[model samples]
Target: MNFFEQQDRARRNSGRLLILMVLAVLSLITLTSLALGVVWQLFGQSHSSLWLASDGAIGLLPSWRLVGVVSLAVIAVVLLGSVYKSLQLSRGGQAVAERLGGRLINLAPQSLEEQRLLNVVEEMALASGTPVPPVYVLDDAGINAFAAGLTPQDAVIGITRGAISLLSREELQGVIAHEFSHIFHGDMRLNTRLVAVLHGILLLGLIGGFLLRGSSRASSRSSRNNSAAAIIAVGGTLWLLGYAGTFFGSLIKAAVSRQREFLADASAVQFTRNPQGIAGALQKIGGNLYGSQLRAGHAAEFSHMYFAAGISRALDGMLATHPPLDERIRRVTPEWDGRYPHVASLSLVPADASADQRAVAQGWDQALAAGFSPASATAAIASIGEPSAAHLQQAHQLLDELHPALRQAAHHGSGAQALLYGLLLAPVAGLREQQMQLLQPLLNADLMSHLQALEQPLRQLPGNQRLTLLDLAMPALKQLGTEQAATLCAVMARLIRADGKVELLEWTLLRIVERNLAPSRRLSGHFHLLELADEVQVLLSFLARAGSILPEQAQAALAQAAVELPYTGLNLLPAAQCDLKALEAALKRLNQLQPLQKPRLLKAMARCIEHDGRIEVAEAELLRAVADLLDCPLPPLLNTTSAAQVG
Candidate 1:
């Protein structure tokens, strides 16, 4: 499936998951009512019998009032647990990785293996035009990996130490590509929801376990045998019920996760176009002693999120989050032999990163030499969330071509702040000096020094690479603490307003940065094209003006783009109506577009840009920036002219 189809499917699956969870909850309530009723009848109230159907008899079924009270209690606990997890994860993918015993890979990694891994991830992100996600290392023997987050901006890739040490660079790329597929397919958001939903279901068992332990302690602490016996009975029943509820939850996870793994494996091959790369990784997993089994305490909680099954048990056939090892290999490599590669130990011969990394610069230069044809709107939209080998190669080239200092700066918090500051420094001497004077007191000495150091390089940086630099700095920028991030946002605003006007390119960059720094939690919404009239007008009109210089030209461009909008009576709004502030506000709402609706809207925007038949590199960047804010990751396949000519 393409990006749009996969997203739409994920949206539908979320609904299905909710329905299934509700069914499971209902089953638990019934089972709990019966079990609790028996407990009440057996010990607390001996007068009642064990059946509700007995004619005019007080059976095991408790009074409706008692059952209602118990049911409400269960619901309250479940909701509380679910909400707690949801809020915790709202802190984004980093929270999940940390919870799973993952240590974030420092931007300036010391080890060769870490550097290589970072390079691969950076190339992939650059190729896909996504922010380079922070990578985390789980100090586990398992050869497993996962992509976690509610959105791309906050997404992170996590890998076990074994995978990093055991797999070859190509094989690791295959594995990373598979996880990236999960991010692209909208699976990460679903996975986050699943974690929250299942946490609620499993909380009952945690409570039951706690109660059982408490009763045991009471039996020893106090010589009250009858009270202790009653406690044991209640605790044991709840424990048993909780186990049953967990089984239901596992089945739910298996149902939602199994098929997605297959799709991701397929997508990995599509991404690298290297079947053996992924197949080798799978074979190694099948033969390894630890395989993909994790030692993390919460491994079972995130079982469905792993690149492979992290917890293997007797009921694996029914509860397995991933497919059978041999089965996955066969799908990836149809002619695979029955015997798996025996990976008792890894031949991890360390190599210097500078000497071992691919010739990405050469390859990227080759691609540029060959020339890339500009894509139509449909083709550009299709490339969203789908990065090919060419895109990967180009990403490597782009990163390789970038200045080392600028790149190093992109990888750390202070350096990233300096890089952004340098980008916003006015081109004119007077404006540049004015902005500097304004920033002098606001920024720290260290930050000012970094900005001064990067000034010359930043000014000479290609316009195309400007946005790339911003995206590359995202993970580092995200490292800032709350107040620091707020201050950073304020400084960004001051720099933009230093000249008392907002340029199109600068405004777009500011929006992209701000949105990524504080992403929207919305996955999909019910807002249709017809319902979002004002938003549609603002966004389209803004694009129309950005791509057309004159009033008449903007009108004509707006009309050309309006064909793609599913609404009637759409017209070009006056410049005041679609000012930058209005455009930003409109984008915040358009972000809620349904998965299917986004493509049409993006295509319409593309139509407006190409209405003049050729796109300036700056205009193309603006189109991409707008699309990025809408949560549609547009690829870098537009014009390559060097200057920053927006219109």
Candidate 2:
């Protein structure tokens, strides 16, 4: 599926969820109204002498106004609860991990298992063209993992201890691939929203518990029989209603979560080109005594987010968030004979020297292969969110090719800062000297030395490798204090300006880093394409100019793109008018377009870049950068010869 189309579908699902939530709320309102009606009838019956003289209608039918008031109160309670929980979780995936008692893995892993896990996560990030997310390990001894965040930038991957200790490296990679699929599919946002909505439904149960306790204490303290009885009745009613809410909430979670698990499982197989890897993990989960169960008290709250059902079901699997293990395995490994595989204790496996050398050689070979054609460019666009085995192989090879020191540097805060600064240093001696001069005042002497030392290696790196290193450095760079981050941004801005010209690569690198590091830079809205046509035009013009060397070529690219967009009167802006500042502004606005609109924009972009019937490395890099800026995880554009091409 096209990345934008998937995003649009996710948005639609979110809308459907909202509609379902409204229906649920209405159901709760009706239940509450009925309970209140019974309470009113009982109250009248208890005061029969006073009610006997009045109209007997009071006992038969409850007051309409009272029902109305109760409905309003229930709606208010549920909405307020959901909003409060959503705001709390706005801190992002880190918050969810911490909530479940997960410990963040150190950047420099101390254990072989931790190191292996980190490597797999890094490769997945690189292959998917997303920034490397922080990894968290739950103490729970279960074979489960999850991805959580509102967006890829803030995303985190969480794995159970059992997954690390019980599964082989390939199995672990499969699990990680599944989690990354969730991240790519935009499932985390929906999962978080589900968490918030469910919390709202569960609030009634909490309130009931509080009321019951209060009533019990009051009855013991005084002889207020009538008041005590009244409290007991109300609390008892709410307690039942709370459970009713939970029942429906669990159903909603189950409905939304199960199918996604199947998709992710298939995606994992597609990604690794090894169904047995994921199937083996599943079989092990089935055979192991623990069977993917979590000990955390909050496990049930986010059970649907897990790679498998993280808790045992007492309802005969009715409330299970994931599909049956055997069934899932059957889908991945169709030849399975319905047998569970016995998992042994995990052992550390040493890296193969020959394989490493071969991968590194292969990486360079692939880099120098023929440049992409128009068909390849279109294929690359389609490959977004659907990374194949080739992408995984490329990721592994790229990681192997990176200098060990640079890779290690990407894992730590201080080293990551130096790496970023080093990448920003210009190749020209005069500009490099000026950048160093600007940095000397802001950084300590040790940091300055590190930056200076990394320049030569950074200069020798390939374009894709450079981007991969930047992606790897994201989690570590995120550890910087606000002041330090701001300084880094300032230094980068100065370096980009020192040469008096902003190369496309330089601008893209700066944009990627800044957009990720600074949360305020994230644009949040859902406007239609027509509503943001001017912003789209500006962005398309900048993209066209970035892809072509000549003004006429740029104009031609823009013309190709304009035909795809529905808007008329769109034309290429002059090179002076389409500067980095203008492009940045345009991106900020385009980021606000609705999910469906983004696909159209991307299609147009592909058309613009492939107008010359060739996709140069610079053009491909720019396209990937633009895709990343738009929150789309585009796989690398490998050289291909095909008849079909993207519009």
Candidate 3:
């Protein structure tokens, strides 16, 4: 599905959920209120009251006042507690996104292209007018990445070490762009909501634990009376209910999370205007050693959001949070071969290559960063395009022309050096000597020294830049294609083979290199708010110039889509814009248009009418005029209808 359809669906879903939450709270309150009333009646209507009630002076007792006060206190507590919990859940969502982003920012994959991941994310955010999101690194030796957040202002883009090392710039752009699609079109909000809803469900379990513990302590302090026994029994029941809530909450999280992933993948391709990059990335995942299994502790909770499954060993149809890896590959590759090559058999690089070879690898990396084909250079410049400053703003045009080549290069270039070098050189270098001393007992004397030599320069470089160096060094081993990439990956496996061997940071960096060089991998990129709107404007401008509809009619129709209002507002020339004559001709021509061509045409027209913040009354009238002529109802496009219509 396209972004607009996904966005509309998400918004509708959110509204429905909010309504449900309100109903749930209200129902709870109503039930509680009624129970309180019943309990008061049972206690307040005592024998003394019955005896006095027959008198003319008989009236409601003051006992009801005590019950009323208690009822008000209960209501206040529930409302206040629920509100506080909601806010806490929101903060936790932000925390998850930020924590992940911080790790990615540390990846600094030494390659010029790979280093751009951070910059690209920032650019997208600025373009979209949202705050720049945090970035995180997944230290998996697999080609994958993902974006997660509750909103544009609080989102994160995470990449596997494999992705930074394996995919070229274009492919990386495709991946990042895919994530941005989730960010811009309201998918992030849904993700955040899932986190919150799940948290709310699990809250009971946490409370149950607290209650059970508290009751045990209380029982120790109190006499073994019937009251204590009853309290403990109630606590035990609440604990069981809490666990039940946790089970349902997990299911809910998995269910809602899976569908949006498919939509985000489609959107990523749309945003980058390239299927190959993401498709390539998926292919690498299936072919790689570690695949996409993330080693991070939090992998389970974030599985559904990963570009590929984080910890899954094999794809299971129902349990899967992502589409089957093979299916995902097929969607982009349009080719099928289930076999994947092993990483060790592919390359000739010795885990213990000589000093000279290591230096050569470094040189290759810097050259790759600097090197560029004329065609790609031309493509990058052309991607920017001629700004229609006279017709469209420069900011808008800039947003329209996102290039894939730059994305690929950035993911694998030398420029990434500066970013990584700044973050990790110290901790890594400090540990190197200590590691070397320990490894002396296990390895051949020469192998230990060779590794030690690689460490100093490697440590001298920053995290991202060092990562680029590894990418540069690894290509010699990867050029055998699949086998070579695999072989080089094995060298990485061997290097970390010893006890007290690889530090977390070291392993993370190595995995990053492995993923970058993976044979089947593609890349990804994304756009921000300014970019989205600018592109929308370009589409509208193009449609306004298309024939069959007058500029005014085109403009009106476009405005309807943008405002998400009924077409009745854009008072069109009833017979021309919407009548059978108008539609038949357009539909006939539309069939001749390529996939997405018609949507672009429609979106472009929408742009013209949406120049103002609100849809004009005249625009609404024009739309109705067109709809009436066509004998079509101008209805608010619901989620069910939106998919069919947009598709």
Compare the candidates by lDDT and give the number of the best one.
1
- What's the distance in Å from true for residue 167, model 1? 1.6
> How well is each residue in 546-634 modelled by candidate 2, as lDDT tens digits?
77789899889988888778876778887677788888888888888876677678778999999998887777888889988877777
Q: How many backbone clashes does candidate 1 have?
A: 4
Q: Which ten residues in a row have the lowest lDDT in candidate 2?
A: 349-358
Q: What is the lDDT of residue 161 in candidate 2?
A: 82
> Residue 628 of model 2: what lDDT?
86
Q: Write the per-residue lDDT of candidate 1 for residues 502-531, one digit (tens) a residue.
A: 898778777777877888667456688888
Candidate 3 weakest ten by summed lDDT: 383-392
Which regions of candidate 2 are displaced past 4 Å?
Answer: 40-58, 345-371, 520-531, 567-570, 639-647
TM-score, candidate number 1? 0.93
The weakest ten consecutive residues by lDDT in model 1 span 363-372
Q: Between candidates 2 and 3, which one is better according to lDDT?
A: 2
Per-candidate TM equals: 0.93, 0.90, 0.46
